[model samples]
Target: LWWCPTGLLTLLPLHAAGYPDPADTPAGRTVLDRVVSSYTPTLRALARARKADAPATADRRLLAVSLPEPPPGGVALSPLPGARAEAAFFERAMPGSHTLRVGDAATHATVTADLRTHAYAHFACHGSQDVNDPSTGALYLWDKPLTVLDVAELDLAHAELAYLSACHTAVGGATLPDEAIHLAAALQLAGYRHVIATLWTVGDRTAVDVATSVYTSLVDGAGLDLADTAHVLHRTVRALRDADPRDPTRWAPYIHSGA
Candidate 1:
């Protein structure tokens, strides 16, 4: 299912909606159990993503950015100790095909430059959504924040998947309710064929587990197959849901966007 939600509907986790209790529905009631869901800002956006050429096999490099600690002289945000684990998983999974940038190395400039060169990008950090102005929403880095506007301005021709392990990446501004102007949408606008984002704040430990499972299923001896991304995420989330059937919070926030 390719969802193109407008206004407040964009803020909800439609893919996870349905009866949470297994006893209520024998075959499982969630949208996730029924189909592999992905979001797009519009039908035209989906069409454009589908029309774009796939990234070359040789160019399937991964850029993994990890910001476990907050930047110096800034608003004191809680540290994400699990980001390091997530970064390490990417290194182990991709090995020679990955660039691991952590701590002071994950600067806005470096990440932006790396995005242009890498076919796949993964950000494990703090994400802030400016509810007043969604375009100002950003993924916190070393030097500064990589704003939605910053991402939307870029033209990443080789871009494939961008797994945003940070929080509220898919949440749009309440002020501009109809506008699809969040970090996830911005990445799609920047030319990423697919994006994995969260609808709200997610636990650091949970993020690590989800990333590990999702990537494990997606990665092969050669490299990641972008075609399997949505289904892989669906399966991963279903497993998570099965582990704790009552707590949708543990599994539902993670969403896939674009092609």
Candidate 2:
């Protein structure tokens, strides 16, 4: 586990830090190369997510959203070319997974309503971070931003996992170092048992590929287990880091933020 000792640390990806020397042996040199990691805003929040394990069954549902449109009055966001691939991965890897593709149908209300019905969720879209008001940080939808406060208001007992493939989903306010007022923590507060989120803005292509690899590993022939997810991400990120030893940004932003 990585510790965020200050507000600045909350904005950085501590888990992604690499070896002090390039020539150093790859074995156990980085967090990703060693243990399965889970991020928690606090020890209490971590305990809540681990209280119950996700049930393994064919009926397990995943709600995937891909928002390719720019929001009203918001800065224009280039459509995520990787969103389709990310959505397709969930559909193929998880049984009974459903997708809300980028289109007229994938509205905010629609996605919010679907959240209540699904056990897992994947959001492939733009994220807005309000540095002054961390609770206002949001994940963009077709109609509006799904703010952190909106997520906290939810009572989703059935929700088990959430993959936030967006920018700075785990970033919190500089003013509130201990509160953890960010999208990743908000989702956990809302009831997700495990959450895969990014610590900063991520590359479009790498995000899709890494997200796919993580899910594929978790849902291997045996089936998906929530406890195994952290290791799955660790292995996948390590592989990405191995492919390019110099670029920690490519593999380091992603983190498992719950049980």
Best by lDDT: 1
Residue 174 of model 2 has an lDDT of 79
- Candidate 1, superposed: residue stretches over 4 Å from native: 22-25, 176-178
For model 2, the stretches where C-alpha displacement exceeds 4 angstroms are 2-6, 24-27, 53-59, 71-73, 99-101, 177-179, 220-223
**Candidate 2 local lDDT, residue 51:** 91
lDDT string for model 2 (9-74, tens) is 777767765565457544566656556667888777788888965655643667888865565566
For candidate 2, the clash count comes to 0
For candidate 1, the C-alpha RMSD (Å) to the true structure equals: 1.5
Model 2: worst 10 consecutive residues (lDDT sum): 95-104
